[model samples]
Target: MNKLRIGAATAAVLLALGTAAWSLRASGAGHTDASAPAPSVLTVEVIVPQQQSWPQSVQASGSITPWQEIIVSPETGGLRIAELLVDVGAVVKRGQLLARLADDSLQADLRKQQAAVAQAQANLYQAMSNLQRARMVDGSGALSAQKMEEYRIAEATSRASLDSARADLDSTRLKLSQTRIVAVDDGVVSSKSGVLGNVVAAGTELYRLVRQGKVEWRPELDARQVSTVHTGQSARLTLPGGEQVAGQVRLVAPTLSATTGRATVYVSLPAGAARAGMFANGTIELGAQPALTLPQSAIVMRDGRAYVYLVGSGSQVTSRAVSTGRRHGDRIEVLSGVDASARVVASGGAFLSDGARVTVASVGSAS
Candidate 1:
């Protein structure tokens, strides 16, 4: 009986010891599995920066206008419009007759004035003869002293009357010449405000002329940009159809616009290249600038911030913040946060994280 009880107790103790050992081993293995690091393996593209020559330029936009617009009006009034010699869009030379007023009245007035001039000349001749005779008779007492002085006064009065008639004739002739409305300069007629047989008043606008057929681009830019631009700077403008036209800066505004807080830059385009009222966008080349740039595909933006994936040894990548500048083509200028020699993930930055391990499956071509 004693031996049987001792054997049973020994068996129970041995079984308890085995069970505790198995539990301890299982718990230790679970802890070791839970604490182990996860594997981070990814395929990525890498890039090495290469310095290249690049041009620096600024963008601008504005409307095209005539180099000079002139207002054409008539000098004389109270006459009917008789003839419109040229129409809108007509090329005209200086002093070319654009329109004619009813000259019948003017011609009649001119003829009447000519007759008056002839009568004035006849009177002047008569006055001269009388003055000569008065001089010959003066102091000779051909008549009393009072009579001689009266003849001299009469001769002076006649001469003054003849001069007044001649002045009236000259005035009438000038009015006749003004009956024809002519161009003041060589230009293309842009607008016309004339009606045949309709009476027009003096100084009534007849036509609007674009002087010399030259067009200019007037680009509005911020004051800071205006300071860098100068006359003679070359620029290229893009038209509505994407046609690029070259132009040269002709003038820079001396003062900024008070309302818009911008300055105007006048760029002259090639003749017949553009017309007034054309809106265009352009870039002013500021010359070449040395820059450290990377492929545009390498940049990543998150939470309204710019980032880049920098690749280090062992294919480990770090998410780095970067400040970027101008963008040229597919590449962007890196102002800071990455050195020239830093290798970066060319693309697929969105899948990258800080301290992530990666492998260069394919390397991007050098830019």
Candidate 2:
């Protein structure tokens, strides 16, 4: 019975020892699994910087206006419009008759004035002969001094009346000449205010004249852009319907407009079929500028800020803030925050983190 109990106790002790050893091995395996390092993963591409040409530019918008405009008006009152010789849009030369006024009464008055002038001339000749006779009588003492002086005064008064009548006749003739409305310059009639039998007063507007065939394109540019525009600068204009016309800058405004913060730039187009009020768009060439340019894909924006990823040694990338200027075709001008020696990431910058490991691929290689 003692041997049996002793054998049972020994078997229990061996079983307990085996269980403890298994627990220790399991804990050791767990520790080994926990201590193992994680795998490092990164994918990247090589970047290079190159010099590129850039253009200095300023953008603006404006409307087209006429170069010259003239308003024609009637010069005399009580003139009835008889005939409109030229209609709106008719080309006319300087001093060409545009309209006629009913001057029948004026003509009658002119003829009466001419008859009066002839009668006055006859009176003037008679008065001169009487004056000479009166002077001769005064010298011969055949007339009293008072009577002779009175006769001489009468002759002088008659001469003065004749001269006054002649001047009045000439003035009436001049007024009759003005009854014909004439163009003061070579131009097209843009507007007409005349109608048959409509009486017009002096200075009543008759027609609006615009110089024919020549039109000016006046474009407004901002004050900052105005400085870059020079006389004779080449400009390309895009009209309605996508028609392109080339011209040169003929004039620039000397003062800036306080209301619009802009000034006018006049572009003189070549002779063609263009009207004064045609809508147009144009671009003027400013001078060129040197700039650090990079592909547009290399730039990224975050939190309303622009940045580019720069690759350093060991295939590491660092995010750098940048100031940008004008954008060209497929590239952007870097105003600051990048040097020619730094390698800017051209793609896949959104997935990158600072200090992350990376594998740099060559050009044309898959990322």
Candidate 3:
């Protein structure tokens, strides 16, 4: 009876142990089902390249210069500059007095000329009276024919002397007018070389003027670029001080430079827009044409080449290398490599890799 009782107890213990082991296994399975992770899907935005009319342009760099520089010089020689009126950067009008030469000697010569003119007039009047009197007495036998002929000859001589004196007076007046130096055109004085009390020679440069105060940008371009540029095209430039200026193509060089193999394009800027001798970088607008372009944010640079991310089947992003061209605003031209049908990741491409699956938040919106 003791052995049977012990065997029954053992069987009951084994059953209890088996039941507890099964319960523990069930709890572990439930915990595992609750804690297992889901697969990751990166949220992103995608865009489709569109065909839009974008301006065609060429990048150019060159210098700002005067459209027409006028060298101001004195026409008369051997005169001292008595007064300096206009200086550098002075705005002047046509025929405005720029400087005055020492005119004390000229004034004296003018007074002497006036006296000679008066004397000439008196002599001419006397000659005319004598001639009239000689004609009246002719053939009246009041005077001999020889004496009448002599009087006529004297009158002619006096008339010639008066004419010569008058000519001298007119020449003196012209010299006096030259003492006052005047501007040849309306312009802004760019430089001044004349000084007060300095003697000047004929054709001596006194000042430099920017004709009409006009300036132009001369951009050097290669042969291929020069071929496309035409008069009347629009241009936009950035000045040295970061100022923006607008200009229009005035002329294209007729010939290319033999040394540099480049051509100069003249772009006329508005007055006060820029100054001569300023270095500028600018672009010439050729015109507009349809182009396949994507937002600049869609582009990525990798391994020194431009690339874009294209969303493929299964929402997977693939890296695509692209050839880019002109950029306008936030959009960049896709010269080749990608087409309009490809869906590109607008932004956050730096965070992604090839074959990466993404959950697109919105179309045509940046991440």
Q: What's the CA error at residue 144 for candidate 2, in Å? A: 3.4
Best by lDDT: 3
TM-score per prediction, in order, is 0.79, 0.71, 0.77
Clash counts for all predictions: 0, 0, 0
Q: For candidate 3, lDDT tens digit of each residue in 105-167?
A: 878988988898788778878877987887886778888888887778878887888888888
Query: What TM-score, to 2 decimals, does candidate 1 have?
Result: 0.79
Q: Cα lDDT of all candidates, in order?
A: 0.86, 0.79, 0.88
| Lowest lDDT block of 10, candidate 1 | 36-45
Per-residue lDDT over 246-347 for candidate 1, one digit per residue giving the tens place of the 0 to 100 score: 999999999998999999999999878888888999998777888888888889999987899988876788998999888888988888898878888988
For candidate 3, the per-residue lDDT at 272 reads 91
Cα shift from native, residue 362, model 2 (Å): 8.3
lDDT of 2 by residue, 162-215 (tens): 888889888888888888889888887778877778898988888888765466
* Highest TM-score scorer: 1
Candidate 2 local lDDT, residue 177? 89
Ranking by lDDT: 3, 1, 2
Against the hidden true structure, what lDDT does model 1 obtain? 0.86
What candidate 2 gets wrong by more than 4 Å, as runs, is: 1-55, 217-237, 245-274, 277-286, 297-311, 314-319, 345-367
